[model samples]
Target: MSDIPQERRVVTAIPGPKSQELQQRRVAAVAAGVGSTLPVFTARVDRGIIEDVDGNRLIDFGSGIAVTSVGASAEAVVRRASAQLQDFTHTCFMVTPYEGYVAVAEALAELTPGDHAKKSALFNSGAEAVENAVKIARAYTKRTAVVVFDHGYHGRTNLTMGMTAKNMPYKHGFGPFAPEVYRVPVAYGYRWPTGAENAGPEAAAQAIDTITKQVGAENVAAIVIEPVLGEGGFIEPAKGFLPEIVKFANDNGIVFVADEIQSGFCRTGQWFACEDEGIVPDLITTAKGIAGGLPLAAVTGRAEIMDAAHAGGLGGTYGGNPVACAGALGAIETMKELDLNAKAKEIEATMKARLTAMQEKFAVIGDIRGRGAMIAIELVKDPATKEPHPEAAAALAKACHAEGVLVLTCGTYGNVLRFLPPLVIGQDLLNEGLDVIENAFAAL
Candidate 1:
């Protein structure tokens, strides 16, 4: 159905000649801080494949870090965004309001969890959305402290950097981060010390006790977390964990925020991962897959809470650019029409089956977890010890890349091989990608 051919074709090496030249130019032109998972430069992308500069077609497993869940060039997104571009590019929403921006806000309110009266404010990035959510919570609750979980990743901005848990690349030398941001344990089932069954209650108790004793619940403005942890690893919290945390937040009058930047939209076979457990967050920050590869983010919450800020407290020059809003609307349309949520579930079933089969043969696969299209395999040196095998993870990613399949790795220990294929990916292409992964594991 899609224009892009659904196959992996390696005409040249992974980087190839043209991409190598571009990489050299990039080294001189771009900042060293900007990092790329793969060295190949993309020429075009559609549905499940990305054509590299040297004409090699690689299966897209990362989906630009889950930003293109509807595929990079969905017909709806392209048509709406193209029309919006020709009409008007930017008038600045804060200066002169636009229907597209308002429409996106209305859509978010209707789509996010909870049927209560909700309001939304748009931003340009997930970090900006999160920073604003914190501001709104602090203003409404008259408290300064914020509670986040272990291995959680919020963003890279000043305040968000404080909320993020990883250090090396995200927060190594960035010192003096915003104060009053507290950290607690997450219910990571695979690596839970006391085992999976006890992980839920034990971690929830530790977090609650820590909040009450150390931070004092009354002083905390918000308890922000990801229903399924992203960046810090695609680690889904243990069952019963989110509900207990929600109860504590409700009892303490703390704003419970769900950072669904990476796990939101139709990526997890649901509009939002929180829906999986029937947990409704007071404030939800969404980005990434929200705008069909365009930069758009939103903070949706209860009407009273969202309206707490002063009339002029929220807004940015390019916060809700009309083009991005149009893209978001189109993305939502595509999601609904194509039923990408159900597609995500199908992807999960297919990938889980293949990966589980691979696990039986590869003892290095310590854990296979995640939901829907957002899946990952944790690599370890030995199953008995469960020691992280970051090297193996890196090597496997390299192997996949060399063979013309793009994969990405994450986790605090960096031993996670994450898969975020587009929902529109063909089953044959998906199976081919899995075959490449299996061969890589077998070779190891």
Candidate 2:
């Protein structure tokens, strides 16, 4: 539907001369710690394709790290955000509340899980939303301890860095994290000490036991989890894991928070991934895909818990800026109009079938997991050992990039090759991208 050609066009080599030049400029200007998966500077994006500075069009498998679920150039999103931009860029919503922000809150309250009376607060990024959610949880419960799962990625801020599990890129050398944050085991099936089938009940029991003995469930303010783990290799917790956790939280006074930042907003087949098990949380944090690639995030929760915070305790200068809110409203509209949830299911089926076939052919593919469009393959050196093979993941991503497909790698061990194509991607283009990945694996 978009005027831009929907096919991958490699007129030049990956990270061609123009991108190389830009990369050099970036090295000189940008911070060293900030990295790029593909060093190709983007000139434009049309639907699921990213046209780079060198005029090569690449299929987008990473939607700006799962932010652009409605596609970058979605008509309604562009139209509404642009209209807001023309009207006014930013008046500081804190100084003068706007209709757009309230509309976004209303949309989140309706869309996020739970039927009980709910309230919503908006923020600039996933990290900010998480920080506020923690504050709100503590305020409501009058507790100090916070519990997070291993292999979970919350964000990069000081507090969230403490909550995250990865070491190298995210939490390395950054120490003296905020106090009172505790880490417990997640239902990482593939790597579970025991077999994966028992990972659900066993891991949940272990985690709950840890909380009960060490952290004391009564003193814990929040138990935050990503229903479908994102940066930690797209690990979907075992079947019985979440329900058990939710039950314990309800039994105690602890707030159960679903950090649906990366997994929310139809990135999964459902509007939110938590719906798969019907496990609703006390507070759900959402961002990334909420605002058509704009920087917007939200914390929607029960009214009693949300109201625990003072009137001015939950806002920021740029939180829910009018332009970002307009984009969010437009994104919600697009999701409904296009029925992206169904599209995500279609993607899941296609990916599961093809990747399962790949697993049959390749010994390195130890696991193929994830739900909806947020799928991944865990590579290992040996099937029996299941030793992490970050090398193969790196090589496969590079091969896909060489053929004009933009793929991404993640995981605690960096052995996960994640695919997050835009929901609006043409079936033909998505297949072509998958074909390139298949070929890349064949080469390996």
Candidate 3:
């Protein structure tokens, strides 16, 4: 790994020469469906900075969408993964079992919520874990229907696409989605029909009623939701909502699956975001930050529920690649040794304070919501109307990029500016990134 400085510098235009060349090549070779966020290619990365091919150093505020909470080049991850590589790359855990895979499963069983006997199955992406969780739920309950909330993003796989709410970019034209998937209202405090205070109880009631009367909860296998809505604008569903849903699931024998892919692994100031609500999900899907930038994911839940699937029912060829497992163990070690959870809480405090102040100054900032390092601000055209201002978000992100700050925009309406700085990010760099964002709003 390159020893990148913890400074932001722009030596050339945002994309520069090499990135422009690569972008041109990517336009031809890469699939049209795959989109690039900034078109500026990264060459090297430090804790909180990404150095582009043009030698421009940019303050990283996205952390590859919360994947590198321990940093892209974290020392333990590099060391452990490299050692595993030298030993043997892959024998396929199915064909030849390995200790690393079992170790990772054990770590997940210990780390995830709930003390009850638990088991875990590993995969290569969040989508795969989610798909497997649904499979386990269906097998366990002998039911087919799977319920998901509005603005909930599970993954891009076929079944996951059916579970996801968004249409355009994700589900558009990819028709003939999987069947027996249902959608319900989320307790989005900002957009609930009633006030924020009523959102929790009301949305839960509406969801429970719909599941009971419309779909018949007995037919439902699982209810999947994000503790903090990720692609849907970082909407932290109103308080009391999750616990209510969990209760309903328990009452009806439906599996409650918390999709904590973006909010888990200490990104949300806790081991998992569900900890905030003190809700224990029957099954939990996790990825992104689990493996220190490695492609790994897992579906962990009650042992009986997880074991419902028949032997050789839930697995893939590269599900628990030895190197990725090593990376996960190291990542877990890094989290405990560094106390990244506390760091996440500290980051949340610093960021909420800064963003809240910005909200006061900027009328366009309609909401500032998120816990820990996974923070975001929603932009609206009018505070009263709350109309999405995607253009403003786009412009603001462009401004930050020009100033050598890497930021990202997301939301159902594309009006949310989310921040997921690495937990190990220096306070100075994070504050500097915030300073750039402040200037961008002023320029906007």
lDDT by residue (281-329, candidate 2, tens digit) is: 9999999999998899999999999999987888888888899999999
Clashes within 3 Å, all models in order: 0, 0, 0
Checking candidate 3 for backbone clashes, the offending pairs are none
Which residue pairs show backbone clashes in model 2? none
Candidate 2 versus truth, CA RMSD in Å, comes to 1.0
Q: Give the runs in model 3 whose Cα sits over 4 Å from its true position.
A: none
Worst 10 residues of 2 by lDDT: 1-10
lDDT of 3: 0.93
The 10 consecutive residues of candidate 3 with the worst lDDT sum are: 1-10
Output the TM-score of candidate 2. 0.99
